[model samples]
Target chain A: MTARTPDSARDIPEATVARLPVYLRALTSFAEEGTTTCSSEELAVSAGVNSAKLRKDLSYLGSYGTRGVGYDVEYLRYQIAREIGVTHDWPVVIVGIGNLGHALANYSGFRSRGFRVVALLDADPTRKDEVVAGLDVRSFEDIESIVAEHAVSIGVIATPAIAAQAVADRMVANGITSILNFAPTVLSVPDGVGVRKVDLSIELQILAYHEQRKSIAPASEDAS
Target chain B: MTARTPDSARDIPEATVARLPVYLRALTSFAEEGTTTCSSEELAVSAGVNSAKLRKDLSYLGSYGTRGVGYDVEYLRYQIAREIGVTHDWPVVIVGIGNLGHALANYSGFRSRGFRVVALLDADPTRKDEVVAGLDVRSFEDIESIVAEHAVSIGVIATPAIAAQAVADRMVANGITSILNFAPTVLSVPDGVGVRKVDLSIELQILAYHEQRKSIAPASEDAS
Candidate 1:
């Protein structure tokens, strides 16, 4: 059998990678509440996933809980965090100081979860020199300089859909390999670059689908 | 075999339900481009899914593309929209007129996709009487009246994490059953209420996972 090494962690599935943060968040909460251990069932409920899936996902990280004891909350938390590379903070830049950008800059979750907002850049000249989250909103052209300065690998696009592609183009050109897109458009990036979108409307649309189903089905049956 | 009814559409898998909106968006773009018909390959590329997966997802909606001529874009679009219940508009109330809230209010994708933000509410008295997205920002206490007035069953929570749970509580008590949360906290909603979250930091963390993997692996071998 091949020896399990840190490199093997890279082989985890994309779906599991996405869910790792959720599991990490749940573990963080458990840690805060002074919980030392949790079974797959308990953690699954907290993560809003099934127990079997939770166990399988944890196994991807080589975290197998004992038969009677269950997972060590703090140990599993550190394991997942290390696997996700969040043990060391990742510096990031947010382009487009619009409402969404402003909210993102002020978001405390990023700071608590190993992400540092190094800079906020906006294309609009009027927005330049404005301060958000204690950082001055600079011109978008400064992205290249700021990114190089902070060695930022992640970039956020909160601009309008019309400007999303341009912003992404700039981000990729400046060596930002991972993007968190808030714009309502699909971004075409290079092979090495990663783009993950958080569309507010799409989330609402999904909820609407379930809400519609609830209206049609009997109220006694929980669609969830 | 049982006769397929409209209610049967509710049985679509959660994964398929998530992709239906994406397919619909792709079809909308095709319609905009004046393309009346598209093969599975073309639609799959537009939706950023594999052709086989696209075909399988469309099959869930009982949409079988023409043997040779491909699928009718408009027909497929309407069918998916009907299946997702976006043809009928959903009136939504947005609580918390902060930066993210402001961005959400002005998001045009919502109006086009099916959600109507009827009222923008904030707890801060200073924010009251402010105009955003052509609607006056109202007091949070007006949630009951505004929800009732619009018959809104959906609510969007863009508040700070500290206030997200409280906002969700108020939304549920005021008769909002479906919530699209942009806050960075886990919301504890009672059974029967559907809550979908769009966490920006979580998305970034997921990307960071992949980015970390790519760094460990050689560039010659694609980690994706």
Candidate 2:
């Protein structure tokens, strides 16, 4: 193996990439509580990860922490924020005005972070009349115009499985580059488009898998 | 590492575990279309994973595929479903009859994948009479009774920030061991209780973080 460089995040594994957000959230909470610095062990305990692994993960972005001292909470938070791209706002349009869409539209997390939900869309013309989360649910026909108007590069698809592909196709066609699919289906976007799915059943099944393991193993472990 | 054993899934990594559902969904689509047995490349394309990684992931699952003939459709499907612990019905409860909870209640994904939402709960007594997803949105007080009646061990909390922790506390107190939290706030759950969060904003923040990198990079080789 080659010696890893100081400023190289590229070498960080995907598992670490996924955990960065968790750490970021933990740091954000700490910052809220007026914490200015935190050791790896402290951060890991709060973030529910191992201390060594936490240090290694942060080492990928650069040595943000001091040897034997710890990390400057504010500075480290800013670096991660910059690294993750929440430094600036990324306008997102949520397509689908169903129950999920309504929750998303009302969610303040997007606006609080770097994401801004600029549009709420639905295919049914009847839905256009309903007001959700203070935004009128518009027809899906206006997706292109709305996306173009807002310069939205990211899109959220909370539509049903039947409409997921069509919505994805339209989003990709409209030049939306990133997608967060809440639909329980496999979406096929072009090569450059990034897609992440948040499936409800999958998570449950995963838990059930572990639950099964716990049930089957009555000894040789913490069994909790 | 020692030579990996064939026909075993204990060695599958967490990353591979997460993607199994994606592959299973893809396979389901193919099965519905009357396709039998698919090569790794075809399965990879459908699952949106690289062929090599897909092979590695499946290899950890078992030698379900013939060396030269590819994977047997029904056999692999059953193996994966059983592996995911979804081959049996898993009863679930969705608390918070708000939009997201309603969407989850209406989603057929859970129904098809061994999860059945047995109840919907909201803390506000006003929502008790409200109907969502063909089921009555009951008071949050119903959690204990519903869990006992339905034998529910899994809980989905789609409540607002204020109600999330309370819901989780009540669920855990009532013997629910697993949680899929949709609230933006960080939830503190006791040990032996599995909690996974799917934040809409967090996903976008991650994408935005990468998207911002795209705009700021003058010239760099980092692809994280």
Candidate 3:
């Protein structure tokens, strides 16, 4: 097997890494509309980013648009997908089969975007044997075995705030290294473990702050 | 009423605005744990931000901790909450009562964090009158009346991608100016309206990208 380049993975900025998926999605849309090639300006508009930033981001992947011909959509799309490591399926185990958990398990986007829900787990024994998203809810104790069985590295925490830390700790001990926490509380994880928190309330609170500003300063409302 | 400072709202950067809610949550935790005051270092660790950055963010609100005494916990909490505009309830309407919508409706965080869900709306007529979070699932057509009745300025869209843009357009026309979009689509809103998108898949993809990097470059794994 050929060795992958190590520097390529290390050189991309986190901000650019975050936007790669967005650019991948935009390319998918362009391809769907039967567009084979797109200028940086066109792709930027589709991705809701400016052209210069888009070009700079793509430069990290060593992709440069031709002087006049622009980028080839399919090639750039595959490059981004490979760079994001989503070209192949990544087995994910989700804990906490609550309402939000159910929504996440049922979300078709995860499966379509190269994440496979290998297991559904909950701390409560009463939830066992319950089927969600075509998978049986297993005991949280099964995390170790499931992670070992699937070689899962990414785990989702949809548990309540009180249980989130314990759940995260358990996931870490069992070799999971990445987390997408939907819990409202902050999680303290060890070094090398990546954590991304998604709080719906926080998102709304930000909007309310902006909305309040808009009403208070109508003259600056158009600034956004 | 006395005129408020016109420049305060515009001066705080967007990144600072997003972190204010997080800081508010951290302070709330400290209060619950019987801590009356906290140093910048302590609060920064709780909020998962660096102390210097946290101090700079708080400076925008005209708050500076006493050199040796640190900051009064309750005072800082209130300041952050007020700055985030969550001291008073903001009536919000959520559209699209699907699995994600059901989860959003049942989320206790929204109600506890100064947001009142005035209505749960869905386009499907079959779901009308179904109870979610103790509120009846109203028709999407009722958005206009509900916004008028509650004076709602924020709307949440948990609809499918195909239905999101239309829902956003309808919301904007009805005087709703801010949106928290959960759909997996990009929305184009007119100037003066604000939109914040929360895509579970995008967040996961970001984690996946990082996780891939960790495995590929074990030497750089601790960069996070």
- Expressed as tens digits, the lDDT of each residue in B1-224 for candidate 1 is 46665445447889998888888888998999999999999999888889999888877778457988899999999988988889988999998988778878987889999988899999999999899999999999999999999999999988887898999999999899999888777789998899888877689889888888877775566458
Task: Name model 3 segments beyond 4 Å from true.
Answer: A1-7, A218-224, B1-10, B218-224
| Highest TM-score model number | 3
Q: Where does the lowest 10-residue lDDT sum fall in candidate 2 chain B? A: B3-12
For candidate 2, the TM-score of chain A alone relative to the native chain A: 0.91
For candidate 2, list the clashing residue pairs, or say none: A84-B209, A85-B209
Among the numbered candidates, top lDDT falls to 3
TM-score of chain B of each: 0.93, 0.91, 0.93
Tens-place lDDT digits, model 3, residues A96-204: 9999999999999999998999999999999999999999999999998999999999999999999999999999999999999999988999988999999999999
Best-to-worst order by DockQ is: 3, 1, 2
What lDDT does candidate 3 reach at residue A62? 79
The global C-alpha lDDT for each of the candidates, from Candidate 1 onward, is 0.87, 0.82, 0.91
After superposing candidate 2 on the true structure, give the runs of residues whose Cα lies further than 4 Å from its correct spot: A1-13, A61-72, A222-224, B1-11, B161-166, B185-191, B219-224
Candidate 1, DockQ score (0 to 1):
0.66
Q: What is the lDDT of residue B81 in candidate 2?
A: 86
